[model samples]
Target: MAARKRKQSPQHEDQREKVRFYPAWCKRCGNCAAFCPQHVIEMDQWGYPHAVRTHDCISCHMCEKLCPDFAVTVGEETPSSVSRRGAAGPSPGTEGSLVSQDHSPERLAKTPHPDEEEHD
Candidate 1:
């Protein structure tokens, strides 16, 4: 007998997932937060990052490529994309650094990367 194909869920859809943030590596920098045109990112009480409006994310990869700590990641939420970009890559603020850390959250509740659960 032939087996039937499994049905896919809405969560499995390619465009449903939003960019991911790596809290451990994040230096609390506001690069990704500032670069995001969608304003999807938001700052926590302690000055950490959080994805307040994930659905608004446009997958522009601006936050990913601009993150100084490689803390912000983008693209489909599939295992393949994670593995491809998760590998050991040069840390942010290096030659390919997309954003600078000049702004401070103390002055304002600057945007932050989601997934960074830390308070500050």
Candidate 2:
């Protein structure tokens, strides 16, 4: 007897805005992939979770809420909230690092440092 093959669903863009995974923060617990309602996440060969079908995402936040290591995040990036890759606010793996607002041009401005000695 042969195993029956499941039919693949048509892919369409959904409500999810962005999906990022911090491999450094992933402990390979597999909760994120296992809990995805849409089955959009998959485990890599090394056991890290990755988005297989981002368009299928429903923005349900099940993966984010279930991640014990905080390795997964699901949020929409508006025009005002857009940031360059690796330059957004705090991410899962970054600890003790200063995070500015999104990568807006204004966010690049040099602000006065509280610890810096003021010049007369």
How good is model 2 by TM-score?
Answer: 0.53
* TM-scores vs. true structure, each candidate: 0.51, 0.53
The CA lDDT of each predicted structure is: 0.57, 0.60
Q: Which stretches of candidate 2 lie over 4 Å from their true place?
A: 1-17, 77-120
Global CA lDDT computed for model 1: 0.57
Candidate 2, residues 1-117, lDDT tens digits: the string is: 111233334433443336766444557799989988778888866575778777667789999999997667787654333433343323323453243222233333333334333
- The residue-by-residue lDDT of candidate 1 on 33-112, one tens digit each, is 78778877777654656676665666788888888776676765555334434322323333443333343323323334
Overall local distance difference test of candidate 2: 0.60
How accurate locally is residue 104 in candidate 1, as Cα lDDT from 0 to 100?
37
